[model samples]
Target: MVHPIKVQLNDLMVKREEFEADVSLRSERLDAAGVGLHGSLLDKEGYPRADIDIMSIRTDRKRIAELTNDHKSVTNQIEKLIQELHAATKDSKPSHDRPSAPAASTTDKPPEQSNGIAAPVPAGRPVHAAQYSRPLAVVDGVSEASPASRAGIQVGDALVSLGGASWESGTISLQQIAAAVQASEGKEVPAIVLRQGETVSLKLTPERWAGQGLLGCHLRPIGDTTRG
Candidate 1:
């Protein structure tokens, strides 16, 4: 019989795959509507496009959100299962087999001499654990005629930092980037991204264009499975 933990892992994997497939379907619908993955299905004037079914797209987006939540829940369950397995293994050791205390230190010895050696110093200031950077967001799709397209931004690029704010995997949201874009108005914003195996810097400008949104691209948070 398969181990219970293994079975749970398998189930989680299956759920993740199903989530990915659902996201793919949603993306296809967006593409059919002539929009990028997260791109608004609207016009330059902020009006819904006449060529696409807005209600249908809204429904698909809602379903995508539900699937995303389900995936996260399954992932958390898998993590808990793994932790339990680890704890069980540690508990399996016999109490008598545990290492005995070290023999009492030999006769109390005098304090060791400094030997003229200075204590080691840290290289830099300690950073808070919460300050670490994580996968912020990923470029899902880019409009062919948009400013982002003109700036050489492509789909699948993982955005690490934009303007002066850094994105952490679960701490930051796409709305932060949107706010930055709006604040920039029509000016160029410096952005750092991880593309493939290399890091690249680009200047992205958000302005009125022929598409719905200013940037003309779709951005999804890194925590979401719709990264493609």
Candidate 2:
């Protein structure tokens, strides 16, 4: 799901409008100032005053150009995001309420997923104690029987530990620890698996499965057991 808070289309639109307004107002003021300065130079008949006035005008023009570019860039970004938002919420109107900055809800999506590691929890309904459990970690795959499958590790097994480390389900940042698995390729990473009413230890090396290398297991939270 796309997070609306991290890069809010509405907020970007507001900023774009503000910048465009600033550019228009500043440009008009600049033109008026140029006309007034010209009249002053004509009356003064002084080279020093004319040079200073011209330099100041040039500086103002440059600043205006920079701001105009910024406005245009922001406008384009807003347009693109509007298209994306429309696609995501098709047939439904999006909430116009602006989310807070550093949108905790929107910006929390994982950058990438690899090595069977999960990303930080995205915004979702809170998991109650009844719906929590150990997530199963797969450590190896092989040509014959996958280690997890051979050991009867199914999709819903809660992973209880990794090399005896306490497995905190639902909150593991899979993106953060993918490197460790890549580095441990061919080496057995001891995994503590929690299957139906039982937990067992297994050491297995990573192997390719379904295109990407995996230990071939899924995890459920401890709360999943008590959930109706």
Quote each prediction's TM-score. Answer: 0.41, 0.31
* Model 1 C-alpha lDDT per residue in residues 97-153, reported as the tens digit of each score: 644333444322212226532111121222222222354766655677998898788
What is the TM-score of candidate 1? Answer: 0.41
Candidate 2 lDDT score at position 147: 49
lDDT of 2 by residue, 2-79 (tens): 457325754665675577567677677667775532334343654445443666666666777888898768755654
Give candidate 2 misplaced runs (Cα > 4 Å): 1-7, 35-52, 91-228
lDDT of 1 at 105: 49
Could you tell me which residue pairs clash in candidate 1? none
Go through the candidates in order and give the C-alpha RMSD of each one to the true structure.
16.0, 20.0
The per-model lDDT (C-alpha) reads 0.62, 0.46
The regions of model 1 sitting more than 4 angstroms off are: 1-133, 168-171, 224-228
lDDT of 1 at 208: 94
For model 2 the local lDDT of residue 8 reads 74
